[model samples]
Target: MNFTEQALKKPRALLLLGICFLAVVVVLGFFLKNSLISAEDTDVLGDFVVRRSDNATSFFTFVSSIFDPLGTIILSMLAAGIFWLVTRNWRYPGFIFGSVVASAAFTYALKFAFHRSRPPLLDHLVDETDFSFPSGHVTGTSALLFSLAVVLTLRASSRSVRILTWLAAALLVAAVAASRLYLGVHWFTDTAAGALVGTGTVAIMSAILFSQTKQIPAS
Candidate 1:
């Protein structure tokens, strides 16, 4: 099937892409996050992540630094409240809240299971943590924001509004991932892994929700 052809018309051709992308990400993360990397490659790639950090300076790093776990949590709470007030739908709120909780928990569990260490910091701008692979910031924010994006796009009527919302959501996700890497707290691969995991979680939940959409009565 020509996805591009379908995407131009159907738009939600994202459903199929989401499935394949999630499946591949899950499999890749399973191996990379757990299996022992070669000492040479580990040293090389680890150095590359660090080298990417070394370029950071006064404003670029700070400007690129767009996320904090605490901020995301607070925002999620406020967004949840607004969402509840506007729609009065409980399950969707539950889905958003549940996605964040489940994604965060799953992230930490993977971190502990793999027991990957934080990037070897040359200069610390902020507090450091123990296990660093699959950054909590990236996973948490992406899970919440992307899930909300999916919900909004699904429910929106105006084509322009839906497209704009999705674009903004994608930007937010990218910023969150970038912030983790620029801060030197997470390796590039760690951010990649976190994004993949977060996106995969969103995809899984979307599939479930889409399946159930048929049973829902029109509002």
Candidate 2:
């Protein structure tokens, strides 16, 4: 669509965009909790998680690797590439691309803003050098799965397919989040914020695209 056509759809998209924006702000606020408060929250949660750590176990270590940002991006790109070839439409890939990029940018920005350190109470399964207010793994993986779920729902012809897609997405996100915590690489709150931000990015981007589509008349 042209600029004029896109501009016309903004009204319909505004509400969802606003809601998504608010959700992000709320998540950021959580990260901005007083240093002492945030530290305590992380400490109690981190200690509890570390006490149950299975870092020596290869299972969760493997799971964590599966959802690393690179893995998630590769999978997302492959899925989007297939969709593009089959339907010869850019919308699917475009939306996925935008969602992942936005999630990643925000994740990094927030990490710098909060500068919360990773849990020091336990050994890491893998070495990481980034600030850890929000788990980039969780954010990227959640964006990949959840945004794909949204695309699946849009494409599905049956309610059952849509339901199953969303269920699978939820399970994947949950597993990745748990793996991050279990790996001693992230605090519970970091994963929580990452989930919110990732999901919210998809919500906002998809709503904007939906708005533009709604303005198009049936052929």
How high is the CA lDDT of each candidate model? 0.63, 0.71
**Candidate 1 lDDT score at position 127:** 68
Estimated TM-score per prediction?
0.72, 0.80
lDDT of 1 by residue, 103-147 (tens): 677778777776777655763455677687677788777878887
Off by over 4 Å in 2: 1-33, 37-56, 215-219
- Name the TM-score of candidate 2: 0.80
User: Which 10-residue window in model 2 sums to the lowest lDDT?
Assistant: 1-10
Q: What is the lDDT of residue 150 in candidate 1?
A: 61
Worst 10 residues of 1 by lDDT: 1-10
| Steric collisions counted per model | 0, 0
Q: Which residue pairs collide, candidate 2?
A: none
For model 1, which pairs clash? none
Candidate No. with top TM-score: 2
Instruction: Name the best candidate (by lDDT).
Output: 2
How many clashing residue pairs are found in candidate 1? 0
lDDT of 2 by residue, 164-199 (tens): 888898888888887777667777777877788777
